[model samples]
Target: MSNMLLTVEQAAEELKVHPKTVLRYIREGRLQATRIGKAYRIDRAKLDAFAGVASGRTRPPHGVRATVIVEIPALTTEAAERMATFLGAAALGGDAETRPLHFNTAFDPTSGDLKIVLVAAPSDAARLLELIELQLGLSR
Candidate 1:
């Protein structure tokens, strides 16, 4: 069952449900999936398991995993404090709808030098960087 992979829409169609519902199931750990970029690829076998079936599936094609680094240059003391606060809220804001990417941040209290690392597929790196830039008001 691992060989066959289905997108969220395809899986939702197979189960006769909305795509958001399918995403919800994934979030609640009811359905199994491997996140690809901003999307998810569900294994056919896991789908069967989810449906209480016993079919073994095969692996699907996967994209190259990559990392993106966002180097936030040293900031003024006040701006650094603000950035820290923003990061705290950003983490809290992520929930079921967030991407399956991994994130790590290194912050310097005295120097105000910050570095953010995001792990995702190669294709998603740009979008993730855009999001981070927007959050930091760099777009303006």
Candidate 2:
């Protein structure tokens, strides 16, 4: 069966639980998902497996994906743009076998809040974090 992507609300409805519960499942590593901006998309096969349905597809090993969220309050717009640009460039130069990298940056100039979400292979995640640390003078 072709896998369909479901939103958190949809998955929660299917499981008869609140949307937050699905988010918890994702956070606890009980379910697999692809982070899109501030939202998550769950594969139908994974949802079926989580619900104890036979999907005829084996689940991939845990920790196959690495998700990193970084928040910077009071960050200047210039700084946010610089960080995003640097991270985007770094994210684009990975091996083809590496999982596609997702780098999302949300900035609110009014509040000077910057939130960055990155999802990719573990190595790629680490590298991106290093870039971020270096960019923000957090290297140690």
Candidate 3:
């Protein structure tokens, strides 16, 4: 993570607001900052979040990300639990420097429907897809 710190004045300039406004945001918890000996230091990423802009910190340069939603028409509870465990383990085993993977699952017991949402790098997504296919005995 970049330790880039911006002073209140710098943050205000980037935000196109007054310095006091930035301070007010800090007070209101709208913006996150660190107080160092009476001076507030704001993170560029935090500022970007407050401004409703995408931070460069999220996506690495030249990197490809994938968002995949997989739906299983029918799955047993035990099978779904096993799949979830396997996917979660894979997500947790990703490289430390790489962007973290987001995995979510929803299941309907009555309908035997299982839905999985995965946000990860392209390679990781492919790996997870392969695992899912293998678990489901589906070729492709």
Candidate 4:
């Protein structure tokens, strides 16, 4: 079989689903694709993998237990700015744009630390914690 890459629309057509459904699959981690800049190019094999044509199941590699949301309060303007940059970088690095994820920041004068909330897959919670530690200079 030719290992041709397909767009979301094409994949949706083949799967008899809507483009949004394909997007949802990508967001939910039920499908995998190659990121070409801002676009996702999925190969035929990957599409088959997602459809369970080969695997017989469309579940994530592991079960997701819960979603984690973290809050950090910013005490200083400098810290807040730094945290914002770090969060953006981390999101990009984590490919969160194509995954089930939400990242946001807020300020609280009453608290002394930067506040960030990350709602993500349970498997990624540990990575989020590691990012928090790195942000707090607690981990290298």
Candidate 1 residue 79 Cα shift, in angstroms, is 5.0
Q: Give the TM-score (vs. native) of candidate 4.
A: 0.46
Each model's Cα RMSD: 12.4, 9.8, 10.1, 7.8
Give lDDT tens digits, candidate 2, residues 26-103. Answer: 775556789999999998866765565545544456748788998988888898888777766676454323446776
* Residue 99 lDDT (model 1): 34
Give the alpha carbon lDDT tens digit for every residue of 11-115 in model 1. 999888999999987875557789999999988866655654434333235636688777787777677656545544443333332334455677776777888
Q: List ranges where model 3 is wrong by over 4 Å.
A: 1-59
lDDT of 3 by residue, 1-140 (tens): 54689999999999899999999877755567899999999877666655645545455577677999999988899988878777766665543355666778998999889999998778889888998898888966
Compared with the true structure, the alpha-carbon lDDT of candidate 4 equals 0.67
| Cα lDDT computed for each candidate against the true fold | 0.67, 0.78, 0.78, 0.67
Best by lDDT: 3
Q: Model 3 residue 22 lDDT?
A: 94
